[model samples]
Target: MACCDDTCAPFDGASPAYRRALLAVIAINATMFATEVAAGLGASSRALLADALDFAGDAATYTITLWAIGRPLRTRATAALLKGLSLALMALWVLATTAWQVVVQGMPRAEVMGVIGLLALAANLASVLILVRWKDGDANVRSVWLCSRNDAIGNVAVIAAAGGVWVTARAWPDLVVAAAMAGLFLTSSVKIISQAAAELRAAAAAA
Candidate 1:
């Protein structure tokens, strides 16, 4: 089977070093996922939930990358499109959840929002650093990079919201950040999906 063969060397299907790096991202992302979820619930913070879901999305993105690393070009392109779609769904979900909390019920715990946000930002930053070196490796690698980069930007917004919360003692700032994060996800989703679709079409033509 292909899995049994060494042809698909893991981590962007490149050298052992790249495989190691990707593996690290996978492990770290998994841990962060659990951490953020628990913290979000404990804090009852929409911002924390946003971070948690963001990490979840990153985990899914990397999982897709690992699965497509050594596949054919057309397969890789299709995988990227699917990954993008998944991201879009996640964004929609987050937006819906945050909107309900903000407009109907109310904002979540502000203190927890800021604290958990900072913690999640640190974790995501580490993930970004880990994947930065492999950003240009392949479509699979680029997808992972885009996911990480988008997440880092979201984290920054979260951090800023935390500061705003500390000062204003309001939920608007947190809601705003959560909405912005969702927007980023939606934007990235479109770009990745379009690129993947074009690549897949080209591959089919070439075949």
Candidate 2:
């Protein structure tokens, strides 16, 4: 019974500290989402908009994670499954937007893209540092870590795309980066879903 209790405890019974970290991350991600979306629209950068959407998705996922804390393993797993679905939807939306931009938009403002991308990187890095300790926790906690990790990676790609656009004066780089970020979202969602499903199965078996 004690072993089962240990296995099921959210954040390994450090829910209080974990919840504080998540709250901070949620605030950072939410703020960055708003700022990046405005910059994305103003600069007409599909990649920037895609990353902004990712930030929004992460913020929501973190909120879900916060809700799951201190709950039973089954409850947390269910919350993670919902987060995974949301991530998949976000990827699909980004892919569609990228396609539309490919057909309609020209080269985005390279300067704006580079600057905003850098700012987003800083924000995500801060969140990553805050959540680094709990990166190996349960599915719900790991999902939050995965989101921040992917966001940091995507931020780097966005910066690279900005540089590519600056050098080539072309729209292809931005569209390519947007597609890549969509791929990241899809991949991470699969991982999160699998982990959550596994937890659910284990919980059922124990029951």
Report how far residue 128 has shifted in candidate 2, in Å: 3.5
Name the runs in model 2 displaced over 4 angstroms. 1-10, 13-18, 132-150
Any runs in candidate 1 off by more than 4 Å, and if so which?
Answer: 1-13, 128-152
lDDT by residue (1-207, candidate 2, tens digit) is 001011222454446787788789889989988898788878888888778766776676667656765679899788877767777787787788789888886769999999999999899778778877766747756655555565677888889999999999999999999888777667767777788889999999999
* RMSD (CA, Å), each prediction: 6.4, 6.1
Which residue window of length 10 is worst by lDDT in model 2? 1-10
Best by TM-score: 2
TM-score for each prediction?
0.75, 0.77
Highest lDDT: which candidate? 2
Candidate 1 clashing pairs, residues 3+ apart or interchain: none
lDDT of each: 0.66, 0.76
